[model samples]
Target chain A: MNERDALRALAADLPHAGDDAAVVDDTVITTDMLHERTDFPPGTSRYTAGWRAVGASLSDVAAMGAAATAAVVAVYADADFDEADLDRFVAGAVDVCDAVDAAYVGGDLDTHAEFTTASTAIGTLTDAGPVTRSGAAPGDALCVTGEWGRSAAALRLFDRGRDDAAADADAIGTVDASNGAVERANELFRFTPRVADGLALAPHATAMMDSSDGLARSLHQLGEASEVGFELDRDTLPVHPAVEAVTDDPAERFELAAHFGEDFELVCTVPESAVDRVASDCPGTLVRVGSAVAAEDGITVDGDPLPDRGYTHGTE
Target chain B: MNERDALRALAADLPHAGDDAAVVDDTVITTDMLHERTDFPPGTSRYTAGWRAVGASLSDVAAMGAAATAAVVAVYADADFDEADLDRFVAGAVDVCDAVDAAYVGGDLDTHAEFTTASTAIGTLTDAGPVTRSGAAPGDALCVTGEWGRSAAALRLFDRGRDDAAADADAIGTVDASNGAVERANELFRFTPRVADGLALAPHATAMMDSSDGLARSLHQLGEASEVGFELDRDTLPVHPAVEAVTDDPAERFELAAHFGEDFELVCTVPESAVDRVASDCPGTLVRVGSAVAAEDGITVDGDPLPDRGYTHGTE
Candidate 1:
């Protein structure tokens, strides 16, 4: 069975299993695991890996519309792993936590054959209760924070770098060579989780979740949880400049922006009357992408069915 | 560098690093990572692996003298791992949480080359403040909850089982042929973390920590953290029956009980006036094996210096 099926079996025992983070009292907690083979690419730096891994869990906290409090990352690496890499990893982890005004609390470490990390983030509810994915209703405006496709663009660059290295040892030519594609890839990989925006949207958004699993899949998840469908305007979805540099085809850019995961942006449903207020109050970019509709209407983008596809772990 | 050295380096970035769990306001949180090669033996069942892995983090919560509220475990295993094993693992994880009155919240899963798990646990402080390791006083009694060397004995049994299997096909004789040694080993491996005892001792204990790294090492750690010395009475050390069954030599028994790790017992310091009260109040067996003394005195057992050795991850 795949991770989803395993999670379904576990859900019977976990009453608070569906949300991005488990809410206990006024606190939100979540965990995420990432491995070297599936997560980090050949040219990825240890710092970027640490930032991306810990940031993923922090994004879960943001999805709960809570104030990021603290995070811990348990590192598992080979016995002979370089000390510099470990230090760099911790430095990146600390910086990410500092960026979000959260503490980089300590965690455990163990020896393993492969490099792996598991991060857990804690957050606190603001004046408003948590904005769960189950709270959306028909007629709510669908919104996404910031642009997408940055990670997808980074992956494309990494693939090209690998191919170039294979062709010639020193021909490690960068994607968009003038811009230093390796540096750009790492920059794209490191994302600041939308914690401030989450807190700002808590008081206004009806339902919210992060688009770490691609916009299309996130919409499907929200639809399933909230029992509502969405009608997205293809023109309104913000595509990152990185995607444009990687591909000229509008369809390819749209696919990368909408279906490729790891955007780390908040996707929420807000009352149409409160949409303008939320946009103004948010600390980051918030764009109106669609409107929540009755479940019978079905989820669609430009009047066409949106494919349910995104990053998933294990074989399905 | 070893895990301890890495931790020392990281301590600079993490102000709240040295404790078993990082305390944020009234909450205590901690994470632990365990891999198959370094942690589990050849015959360890998936259920036991899950129980022991999650239990390690719960023990950290117990050491903080907090009420365990919830736990989450991220499982990373080969893609082709058995579904039945995954189900049993979750069942064990859920049951362990239930035993401690904590909710088994959800977690993430991913594919890895080897079986690995990372678990995080959350707990809340009681009416009394958190009992940290740095609070021990010179006159306090150094006590331990339950017995020691259960896990050590289990390890011995596992080693013998491996040897037996190699000796002759289908031989697999039990350690104590009549007692079903393999079954006993697994039972011994599954020790309940001292959560209840920790709570009971919290109101009275001056300092607290878990003895997962053996009693001798735990005393040294508490001494270092609290800046105190210990004078342990070797005769007073409570050795588990499992240890005695594994070895007939008194020296071997003492070595296993004092130096071997993974017992998951509470090593705490209580005031001289409250020792009797604490022993009676604790839900589990509480043994007064030593007393805190001036730092100049140094740590000793039976007038001899005790070696500070136990289960340490990575080479030290």
Candidate 2:
């Protein structure tokens, strides 16, 4: 079977009413997620690629409400892969681990016939209170650590071969390069959404997750786990400054940000009483963008169903 | 500016490392070592590949006198790779997690232009005391958990490319394609070094490591970490039945067992005082294979310096 079918088969055994595929060790613990085109690609910069490599695992820790502490990176370098390319890739890995305050612990490396990188990150979560996908409850307000949609924009830029849109200021220049495409791409790829906001809201939030997929997809996941629907205010959806500043069409930018993948930010649910406290704390904003509803309503945006459904790793 | 060179430059921040190296976490944690050519490959039976993937990671937890509690699998897949391979791989990983009693808490999967896989397994020390790579004092008696030569024999079979021999007994009988060479090649690829035995012995072993690289190379690592030299009794080596069955040259077979890569058993150093306990309680014999001596001698075999050096990743 192709990878998507395989993923669907495998997803049957994952944390959705399946066995909790988690290891509980004192020295190192790991949760493994397999992503294909859904996560990242070849020829991506050291930064985004590395972020995709590490941020996924770290988000697992954050979703579980644990402080990310360390990581071990394992990658499959192709036959024709350069030694330098491997080094840069690893450096990118180390950079992300450092960014998250995690160390690159021990790991094994080998050459494979295909180009794949799998990372296992170990973190110190001794104080965590067992955050999981199964913890969200009804009546909790749906919130996210930061805005979304930049990664998709970046992917579009990448698709069009807009290589020079590395920085935001020049991003506009590159946006003008592909008829304003770079502006769309630059804003998405560069966002690191770890949600220092989540930690502040942790005491108040019922359940949380990092939105690597689109906001709709993540909300759906939350709904599936919590057995509740969600209603989001389309107007309340926070848009990034660069996304708005670079692109004239606010609605287009907002739409992209809402459903774009790879933001790596937290989609959390808190008690309505604690929203003010969450808003007051956190380096990233704690915006109350939605509220949990009955499952029948499904998840909606501005009283209408979310279109384009969120990005799916294999099939979509 | 190859991958390795860039890695070294970027990892200039790492403390006291070698080129293409593995690091000790410096905590009371355990890790395992595996590579595509050795523990993971398409050559092993389809049923076992996924389990073996987890087994590769679990081997480390077994060595640390710890329980295989959680695992992080880092994978590098080629652009042309299929997701089915990943499914089988994850299947193996999940099976291994179950085997080790650890959860697969978190991992990262990225696509490279090349193929590679790395797994970092985190294990918890069973008791309050933690085992480390150090602690082998002079006069410590050397011990191993199980026989080593099977993987080497398997390697021989695989290298030969015999179809029937490559297939297990049932397969050989049915698919009688006499892949003598393939069978030989498959032999080493399919072996899972004894993790349970290693975990059982972790408490008493002064210094412990899996024979991941090979017996001789592992000894060198233990010696380096423990600041001690070793003397092995070549005649006392545990030659597997298969190696004896497959190879004509006794010395060569013994050498392969001693030096062949992918023998996942643990070769450990136990204080002379605990030698009896090791022998009685552990599955493998306490052959009193060697002694930890002053650094002057350095990793000796049969009371002499090693003739052929041990395995080093990316280098001969």
Candidate 3:
């Protein structure tokens, strides 16, 4: 099974797992993984493992209206687990932890045969009310903080083939995930999570979650979680310059912007009354992606249903 | 290199690794892998992956003087990740987790080309004090909790080896690790980390650790950490009934007892003044294994040189 199947399988077994993070009852949302590009092949400027693990988990916590606090980690490393790698991974985490004003606290490590990393992050909310996927009220305004498509671009530059044509095309066009089409793909991989944005909108937004799986998948998941459907205007959706210039296909460009996930951006539904409040309070621009409509549960573009392929994690 | 060599080499780099657990600054220590019967191939029965992973990580946590709080897991399986196997594994973990009282909160599952089980556990101490192996003061009473040599016997029986020995060996046997050996071994594999013991000893034991790498290697490590040496009396050690039944070869038996590691027991030292307190508080029986005597920087057995396999961790 790929990451998606793996997640679903685990979900099947764990009924209490919350949509935004791994919620086992109340008070925790976990997002832990060893991401690609950044951790290994040192000279490469990928995301660090510590950041990947903690940052991802941070997004999960933020999705649920919680303040970040502490974490513990276990790393099974090879003989090659040198100081430099740790300095990068842990140093990056330390920077983020400091930036967030949290503590590195405690964890453990041992040498295993392969590269294995396990981290359990814990935090507390002032109130224990879990902001689940089931909270969107019909007719709520669907707003997202920050732009999408950059992270997908960055992964391409780092892992996939990076051709200039793709980058150059996307540079002038709108909504191209094509490498050359998106000149700033590299910036996406280093995209800081929307924790600040999440915190600001937490109170006003009826329901929210970080868009790790692409825009469509995230929206679709929100719809599924809240049991409500929303309409996304293809024209009104905010597409990064990276999205337009980086790809050749206009429809795919839109899909990549919508369906391509790992954005770590927030998609939330706010009351019309709270919209201006959130836009004013949130650090980044709060773009109107769509509205939490009265429909059953699915997304529509130009009155037609959009196909979904928001990145699905697979077994490697 | 095999798992042992890999762990040894990795352990070598950790000059500041073990104080209480395998964490130094920010206090971090990590993983251990568990495979099923098919995984060991040559050795099956009376063991399960879930039990092994929990036990292994727990012991390491015990070494760190931290109580396990949560666990994150990554599982790699083929079609054989069956209901029965999963049920057994989950059940076993539930039993151990409840016994340990550590919550099984969150984890991820990824399918694999090979069958692999991995658990990343996080633990913490109430006080922020770090208990390192290097803290053993000369004249410290070298001590261990509970008995030894049960796991070896369990493994022998589980292996169902080619030797047409006269006994069921692990369960019935007359030497090395048998009876309590394999059972203890399985217990080590299935042992909940004695976090309570580690915590109790944290304030009093000058130098402390969970005995996973066996006694010899741990002794060397303790000496290395403390920058001192000691004498271990073979006769004074706490040998289990199964262990005594095994081999008459003191050196070989000791090798399996001390250097074979994975005993998951505790090897700690108390000051002469605090010895009584330690003896009374430990969850397992506290026995005088040796003493921090005057020596260059390694453990001695009855004043004679003892061969040490040390602690090895890694994939075979």
Better of 2 and 3 by TM-score: 2
lDDT of 3 by residue, A1-316 (tens): 3456545544455544646655443345463655232232222231255655666666777677666655444455556766555555565555555555555543444444456455555545545354666788888988887777766555555433333433556543223333432334433455565666766776777888888777787777888778888888888777777666567788767776787777777888988888888898877788887888765556787678866656665421
Chain B structural similarity (TM-score) per candidate: 0.95, 0.77, 0.79
Per-residue lDDT of B80 in model 3:
50
Candidate with better lDDT, 2 vs 3: 3
User: What is the lDDT, from 0 to 100, of the residue A102 in candidate 1?
Assistant: 88
Task: Tell me the TM-score for chain B of model 2.
Answer: 0.77
Task: Tell me the whole-model lDDT of each prediction, alpha carbons only.
Answer: 0.86, 0.61, 0.61
lDDT of 2 by residue, A1-316 (tens): 4433443454546542121124253232444544434555423654455556665666655655565666655554455656556555666667666666666653434455544445555445444454555566667788877766666556655555444444555564332334355434433554553625545655667777777677877887778878888899887877766556445787778666877666777887877887788778777676889898888888888898875366666555
Q: Quick one: ranking by TM-score, best first?
A: 1, 2, 3
Please give the range of 10 consecutive residues that has the lowest summed lDDT in model 2 chain B. Answer: B16-25
Q: lDDT, candidate 3, residue B20?
A: 39
Looking at model 1 chain B, report the run of 10 residues with the lowest lDDT sum. Answer: B172-181
